[model samples]
Target: MSLRLTLHRPPPGRISLAGIVPNRLAALAMADIERLPLAWGKETPALGEFFRVAGAPGPHLVFEGMDARFCDVARGMAAGECEIHGAAGDFVAADLLGGRVVVRGSVGAFAASGMRGGELHVQGDAGERLGAALPWQAAGMRGGRVIVDGSVGARCGDKMRRGEILVAGDAGDFCAARMVAGTLAVAGRVGAHAGYGMRRGTLLLLLPGAAPALVPTFVETAFAADVFLRLLRRHWLATLDAGGAFARRAGAAEWRARRWLGDLASDGRGEVIHIV
Candidate 1:
């Protein structure tokens, strides 16, 4: 029996739903859950005051009718599955350690910041810093997988340490800036400054036309890398849906790309591969 929480009225202001993940709800009774405190602006209100709780307690938790006013939807979730039927605010799955979170609509900034492990699927667009580190954090997204079906804002994977972020649509400027280690792939067009100060990581761009302009710091390479391309194709096949745009384009028989390595300012180790 899965538990469901449906918003019954508009919130007074921005609401923080931190620590309301399935792992915590699984141990609480219906009455106990309703009494849980939710951070609303300067006031703390009972969960029941805003949502109409229903269904049985279980590992599968469903949130219905969420909007931008709701933040930290599934922050620090360590286990189980969570589904958001509507749009979610910032930090949708921040610091997720294990489990899966599916958002049917768009999400605000820092969707998966500080994530250690888990899977976050956004059926719609995502805001800035999709899988990047927080302002005060040293490393972002130590491990996990994030799939954004639509476009993403700037600095998508800034300061990312370890993880995979796949975007089916366009990406904003400064994508993967200062990345330490990770794989970030974009199937559509990429904006300026794709990789600014990246130290070590792989940024794969699968655009159809001519490659977008890259910073002068990146130098082109002549390495064929057939074996690596084949392996990457296999990985994409396993990670993305077969019918998705990214998978369809990545399935090309001739997987050719132009590789550029640089961020000479940051050791010149990171690579930017542009599919031809």
Candidate 2:
């Protein structure tokens, strides 16, 4: 059902494991990639020197090694189920199109930069710019689901255009800057500029209790009585939809959701849903 792989040696320069996810390996056998593309590493002597491969029999390959030192372990990867037993380095799930990467430990900076589609779940803390766009380019996370079970550094979702990013713990400053679309949910209190300059996108906040800071430019639109929240909770949050999005209360006040339009700034139509 599962296979185990231990990496020890690597190759020279930046070796990319761009196509070694479970879904990517579905068609080919492990032996088929013994020497080629399957498990490429960087700045070492050779592939055999770094990995002590034992179980490569099935479709799933479970690697038990210090992967925190390996960058781009799953870069530009499409579909698959990658479960990292240990923490991962920067660019953990960079450019993933489809599939799921679950890190039992922490993650480095730019965790899912430019991810088109897929899901990345980090059980621990995360580094800077968790879901940010590349330097020089624009747009981050066109489509995907990124959930951090713990805390995160600054600029969690910088320039994110689409997708859903949820941080169960506190998020550093600049939670979702220049966001064009999508949703960013932070379970704990946030730092300054939580949604500063956000063109469009929904920000679901639970902490900093009372009422959120009125940016003046945003219009308060009621969402308490909206039926769409029920759909989102049952589908997106599932058991975690404790907010009013799934609440049983309904009234004019309940339907009131402050709608802030701007960061005009951009040609976007994003929504910010804050229910307290």
Candidate 3:
């Protein structure tokens, strides 16, 4: 059975649970798990002080009763599975290397900053910087897939080097700004300044009225996306119910698209596309 951590009471302050992923805790005894130190504001407290733990340590972990005060829910996880049954705070999957993380509720900002590899599925809305770079780093999520079933806040894939980020709902401003490489598909409306400084990547807009203010540096193009659409259908869209349906309709052989290439301000290789 998997270990479970249920909140005993509302935490006094935001708690940083960054290093408590299943891969690290699965081999520890219950006593050791409880004794692990967690940061609560400026003070440190044993994990058991805020949570009631049960079940044997294992590769699967479940967290229940999480709220906005619980931050860094799965930071630096290398492997295993983690499921959060309720809302979570900032940096939900920062620097993740491998594994699957599922959040049943909304998340705070910087949800997947600097992620290297993994699968993060958020069933609810996500805050700003969904897959953005860290303050000290130049690139964001290097590899991975982030699927958000609900809307997302600003700068969703800023400075990304590689990966795929799918937002089934609306995305805020600058959705793929300064991206070096990656694929970002948004199924709903996109806010202003989307792809403002993107250098190299594919930003797919699947719905009407989702156009961002095109950067003047970009040159409109007529490139066909036949191969790109097929790849998405075969690898990504086929896995989700709504996404699959949307992909089928949008990926039809007859479907035409409008493309724009740029950040001529930079390498001028990135593309922004809208399904027509």
Candidate 4:
């Protein structure tokens, strides 16, 4: 069985479980695991104060009875798998170096901000600023993959530098704003002001609903990018195991994608494609 952390005593305030990882805790006994520090606002509490630790650490770590106030449960993990049974608070998997994170429920704002490498899959909606840059940082999401089965809020992929984000549901306004470079695929309608001031990146709108008008600065390109579409399917989407949102959106053999390049307001290398 995988390692499990059951919430026995929910914290009174937000708890920062930043450095807890299976690799480092594999050999720790219950008492030792309890001794691990958790930042509880102004106070530092032992992990055992909030969680009932059971089973030795392994490749998978499961969190049960999570709530909105449980902030930063798996921040900066470099490896292993984490499964959260309930909703997650803000900044989940912030600056993650590597690993796989799956949240079975909704997540708060700024999830997967500045993640370098890994796969983050969220089964429910993501709040504002999903995959966006941190407050003090200029660039966001250096590398990795993020899949949200439900809608995402405003400014998704804002100022992102690299990686891929797939949103199965709708995306809010200013999506991919100021993006340096990345790939964002949205299966549902995108809100207004999309792709504002993006430098270099690819945003795909595969949903059937109407989207906000493209920014005035982005001039439509007449290039037939059949070759690029094939490449995306063969190289990127094909690697997703064919069961996730990526496969559902781009897997059809007859799918056709149209391309538009712009944010000429910036480098002019960015693109927004509407896939039909």
Candidate 5:
């Protein structure tokens, strides 16, 4: 039987679902978490009051028709797949080290920030400063995959050390600000300040547009014998219904990872791709 948590409505105020599900990286004390303190208007309450909890602690978990009022549905998840059926608030999959987080719709701000590993695919659009470092933090998401089916606000993928982010739509300003390493693929047009202070990494453009300003050293190369592109397409396959259909038609296999090097301002080793 598939262990699923049907989230209908969330309790008032901020409720943390961090470590709510056990991951391969660590073990959870269900008894302790169940009895752990939760804030409810200055009062502590058990997690049982809000939504019904079903399923034992394991590597796999699923949420059915999760509400918009809910935030941190799968915060700090380490491994396995967590599917959110609808829209979500902030930090949808913050600090997720591994596994796949498939959101059927859009997401809030700071989505996938500080992520270490795994994939976060948003079927729709996204908010501001996506995949970027949080306040006072040195770097944003270290590694992982963040795919946005639509546009994003400013400062996306800021200070990202490694991983891959593909946006099939448009973007806001300061995109990929100060990227340390990784690949950010924009399918459509993008805002200003692309790769502003990027020290290293690749920024790919699938659409027809001019390169961002404030870039110094640069080189555009043709698609060479790069195997990583094939690897990326295969990684995005859907496992089940609804999403599975989308995956089959995602056109992910259309583009091969061609290599290009640029952002000479930082002697950046990053490569930007162009889809033919």
Candidate 6:
């Protein structure tokens, strides 16, 4: 059975649940796990102080009744699966290397920052800087796939180096700002200044009728690369849920896009494709 940790009471302060991934928990005895120290604000406390731990140790870890005070859930995880039954705090799945993490509710800021590989699926919204670089880091989200079922806040994919982020709902302002390389597909509206200062990447905006206002640095291109669009459509079809917003939009027609290439202010290479 999967290891389960159910919060019995709210933490007094922010709790960092770093290094509590499935791979590490699977080897620890119940007693040892209960004794594991958690960084709770200015103090450290045994995990058992706030959570009731149960179930057999295994490759899957399940968290129940978590709230915004729980940070770094599954940070740096390289293997196995971690599931959160409720909302999570900042940096959820940050620096993930390999594995699958599913958050059933909203996540706070910087979710999936510095992630290298793996899949992070959020059934609800994500806060600011989703997949963006951390404060001390230069690049963000080197690899991995993040699927958000709801909207994301500002600066999503900022300074990203590589990876794929699929958003079913709207994205806030400055989405994909300073992006270096990657694919960011947003199904709903994106706020102003989208793709500002982008160097190299693909920003696929799936808004059907609305032509989002972009920075003047981006100039429309006439490249009707039908083959590439077809391939991209195929990829999204396989990656997203068959009945999700992204899949429905992507599968609606033969892939045709009004492409723009620029942020000439930066490297002038990134492309923003608006579906017609």
lDDT of 1 by residue, 45-115 (tens): 99999989999888999999988889998999999999999999999999999899999999999999999
Error of 2 at 202 (Å): 0.7
Q: What digit string (tens of lDDT, one per residue) describes model 4 on residues 21-74?
A: 665676677678889988876788898888888877787899999887887867
Q: Can you rank all candidates by TM-score, best first?
A: 6, 1, 4, 3, 2, 5
Alpha carbon lDDT of residue 96, candidate 1?
93
Q: How accurate is candidate 2 locally (lDDT)?
A: 0.67
Q: Candidate 1 has which clashing residue pairs, if any?
A: none
lDDT tens per residue, model 3, 1-276: 699999988888888998999999988999999999998767889999988999878889999998888999999999999999899999999999999999999999999899989989998999999989977889998899888888999999999889988888889998898988999988788998888888999998888653456779878877757787667667654565544433444444444578899888988899998876
Q: How many pairs in model 1 have backbone atoms within 3 A of each other, for residues 3 or more apart or on separate chains, i.e. clashes?
A: 0
lDDT scores of the candidates, listed in order:
0.90, 0.67, 0.86, 0.85, 0.70, 0.92
Q: Which 10 residues in a row give candidate 3 its minimum summed lDDT? A: 242-251
What's every prediction's RMSD, in angstroms? 1.3, 4.9, 2.1, 1.6, 4.3, 1.2
lDDT per residue as tens, model 5, 17-80: 5555446213544454346455445677775565555665566666666655566656788877
Top candidate on lDDT is 6
lDDT agreement of model 3 with the native: 0.86
**Collision pairs in model 5:** 133-140, 201-270
lDDT of 4: 0.85
| lDDT, ranked from best to worst | 6, 1, 3, 4, 5, 2
lDDT of 1 at 213: 85
In model 1, which regions exceed 4 Å deviation?
none
Give me the runs in candidate 6 sitting further than 4 Å from their true place: none
Cα deviation of 156, candidate 1, in Å: 0.4
Tens digit per residue, CA lDDT, model 6, 22-89? 98998999999999999976688999998899998899999999998999999999999999999999
Candidate 2, poorest ten consecutive residues by summed lDDT: 244-253
Candidate 4 Cα misplacement greater than 4 A, ranges: 209-212
